[model samples]
Target: MKSIAVKNIKGRPARSVILVVISMLLTFAIFGGTMVISSLDSGLSALENRLGADIMVVPFEATTQKKFDDIVLQNAPGYFYMDNARVQQVLEREGIAQASEQFFLASASASCCSVAVQIIGYDPETDFTITPWIKKSYSDSLGELDVVVGNDLNAFVGDTISFYGVDCKVAAKLDKTGTGFDTAVFTTKDTIKRLIQSSVDLGMNIFGKVDPENTVSCIMINAAAGFTPEEVVNDINLHVKNVKAIQSKELISGVSDSLGGVSGIIRVLICAVWILGVVILLLAFTMSVNERRKEFAVLRVAGAARSRLAGIVLGEALMICIIGSILGVLLGFAVILPFNGVIEQALGLPFLLPGAGRCAGYALASLLLCTLSGTLAAAVSALRISRIDTGVILRGDN
Candidate 1:
């Protein structure tokens, strides 16, 4: 039976190839669209985990709200400072479990640093955010003049990075967060203080006189259990001065809204492609079976059962679907893995590919769906042919 199905497929090379190519295209659309959406979802979740803060307190006089939003959501780098006193005040607020001050310093140019990147300074003693993430790579505290570069940065551990004549060793490298952290550099408060002083002494004070000891770029806060982020934000706004408290969810909401539109478009496209593929395959099978009526009649006269005739038709479609889906899945991975960086830049969204096991599972599911659709498209033609009168077909009647 399988041999007969193979012979039938081989008899019409052009039609068979066309059906296979169509199946491949349909599979590609399904797999590619699904993987991209999955990656985006995973990336956003990772960014939330990396932040692990209920609210971010930036100076009230800092850049406009729009610019600040771009910094956190779009990974745009910028620097501003406010009095460190705000950090202490935020900590003393009701429902605040922990708060840490962070300092920001931007390298003037590539000449001033290994790369043009934002420098973030954190207090290890009070930090509850970056420290825990960094501990995954390095357990010890970041010593004086030691830094941890972001995953996107070119520097690696043990490499020395210079900023305005102040050299700091890269003690560790952080994992990618698909956010500004990927392009920023992190170090202890003492290291940033030295960098600021060095810039002043060397007459390269591009950021003006930065009093590292009394200035802070932002404060990260974690709320106590049973206290919501909105409540924490409201409490901070009421009691804290010269700073703005932004909830993490507030920042993520805008991005999520934008993603909703993109996801909708992708789903529509997937559905359209699937429908078109099924229609075309059904027509192809119907035409092919019409031309093979005499052949099916001959087989039936030779003692071949009607069920066997139907199975042969389905077997041909199954073969094409299996081969096409495998090729399509490989093509999807080829395009997605190599050009992921380009895709992320073009989309301007967080993206994290699924691991090997999950990707394999997705591929298997796609293959099964494609095969089922292909088989169903051929089923009507198969059934019609199986019920044809053997005598009329053998007589060459219309």
Candidate 2:
């Protein structure tokens, strides 16, 4: 019976290929859509976790010169100075719990083709944001002039990278945070201040007249118990001088909404392709069944049972669906896994692929769902052919 089904599919080469393509489309949509949506979700969650702080305070000019999202969430290379005294001022505000200041400077444009990147300086003794990630890579306190590179940075542990003629040893490489933090470099406040001084000496001063001794680029703060982040943010904005205080959620809400919108569009597209594929496969199977009525009648006359005839039809569908589904999954892996970084840049969102086991599960689920749809599409045609009168079909009597 299986051999007969194979022969039938082999004989109608073009029709069989069309049906296979339909099944492939179905699987491809499912696989690709699931992966993209999952990656976006993971990235957003990681961004939120890595931030840790409930609020961010930056120089007012920093907000005007560049959006906060571009400066931190997008890792756009930039530097701005706010009086480091503002940190103490913000800490004095009501409802402020824990706070840490970070200094920022864009890396000098290398003589080579390298573009500028952000250099962030955090106070290790006072920081809660980056310490968690740093601990995962290196438990020891960072030595003077030692820096932790982001996961996506080219330099690795023990490698020395230079900024403004000030070379620093890479003590650790942070795990992927799936945020802009993945690309910027991290270091202690003292080291970053040294880099700032070196930049001034080298005539690459980005913050002209801004005293490195008294400057900080941003402040991260967590709200005290019984105080909401919004209330804390408002308190800081009202009390802190020359600074813009923003709730963390307000900063990331744009990104979260963008992810949601992208995910919804992909889901709609996946459903549209899936439904269209099933419809096309059904029509193709019906047409094929009608064309082969006489062939089936011949088999019926040769003592093939109705159940066997139906089995042959379903077997052909199963074979095409299985083959097509595998091809689709392989294609998805080739395109999505290798080009994920490009996708991330294009979408302007944090994107991290799900783990191997989860990806494998998605592939399997896609294959199963597509195959089921294909088989069901052929089932009605199979039943109709089996119920037709053998003699009438053979005699060309209808």
Candidate 3:
């Protein structure tokens, strides 16, 4: 009986083609939106993990006026060297957990094969953010005039490069972080000082290459468990005059803000697509229900209970929802497969394989929602058939 009902449902134009299209559209919109948001969030999470620093302490003058801009916009404007003693002072504070200092150096044609590479110099013993990841790849301790390159630095592991006339060995390659770290190289504080010493003839116009007397470009602070980043920033501001502390979230928000109108437009477009998909689905369900009233009324006359008639209608809707959702998922994956490189290039980040369990849950939940919505809409028309006078339905007056 169910087979005959399914076949009859399929034979009707409203149940066959339009229903499938609606399911395809609804699934595509929902899943596609999910993928895009997940991509953005994953990229952001990767970046935050790489930074690892809870608070960023830059020059006191730079923090008040757009913190990130002051640090990265132009080296000269953002450049202010706080006393290494002051860095230690912040460390000694009660709420402070740990701190590591780093300086950014930009090198052009550091080697014949590699182009410009940004170098971040850290004190190995004090630096905690990236050392763990780097140590995992290369067990050897980083030495003076030795460095590890980022995955996207356009150089390979074990390569050698000359920086400020000092030869440095590329000990290992860091993991792909999908952030600025991908374009940076890491080295020890001693190596950075030696490079600055070797570049005495450059006359102080360099982006990095600081004197040995100075400790670092910025101090990374990790607050104790009970302490909040904002409270620490406020404390630092009150006690320390020449240093600025920035929270990690503020830093990310700053970066997102710099993305300008493009991100906003993308969000708006995603919303519009969602609305259109829902409208298509509602229209498809309503039309299918309208065209099936006569058939449903006949089922009612043949001693089929109203519940049974409703079930047949709902079963057809479920079939359309399930088939359309599966096809949409497959199609969405196909679209994502070819665009891996494009996504990486556009975001300066690579995508991760979504968790199989999570994706399965998404698919199952989406189909359930779609099927339920269709069933409810069809149920209304089914109930209307139940309201018909039995004598009239028998007399073919549906």
TM-score leader: 2
Model 2 lDDT tens row, 94-205: 8878899899988867652133678899999899998887898899999999999888889889998888877799999998766788888889999999988878877787
lDDT per residue (tens digit) for residues 340-387 in model 1: 778778777777778889899888888889888989999999899878
Better of 1 and 2 by lDDT: 2
Q: In model 3, which regions exceed 4 Å deviation?
A: 5-15, 42-44, 61-95, 109-113, 135-140, 143-146, 149-178, 192-209, 212-215, 224-241, 253-279, 297-305, 336-357, 385-398
Candidate 1 local Cα displacement, residue 273, angstroms: 1.7
Q: Model 1 off-target regions past 4 Å?
A: 63-66, 199-207, 396-398
lDDT of 2: 0.86
Q: How far in Å is the alpha carbon of 92 misplaced in model 3?
A: 6.4
lDDT (CA) per prediction: 0.82, 0.86, 0.66
User: Which residue pairs in candidate 2 collide?
Assistant: none
Q: Relative to the unseen true structure, what is the C-alpha lDDT of residue 141 in candidate 2, on a scale of 0 to 100?
A: 96
TM-score of 3: 0.72
C-alpha displacement of 56 in model 1, angstroms? 1.0
Best first by TM-score, ranked? 2, 1, 3
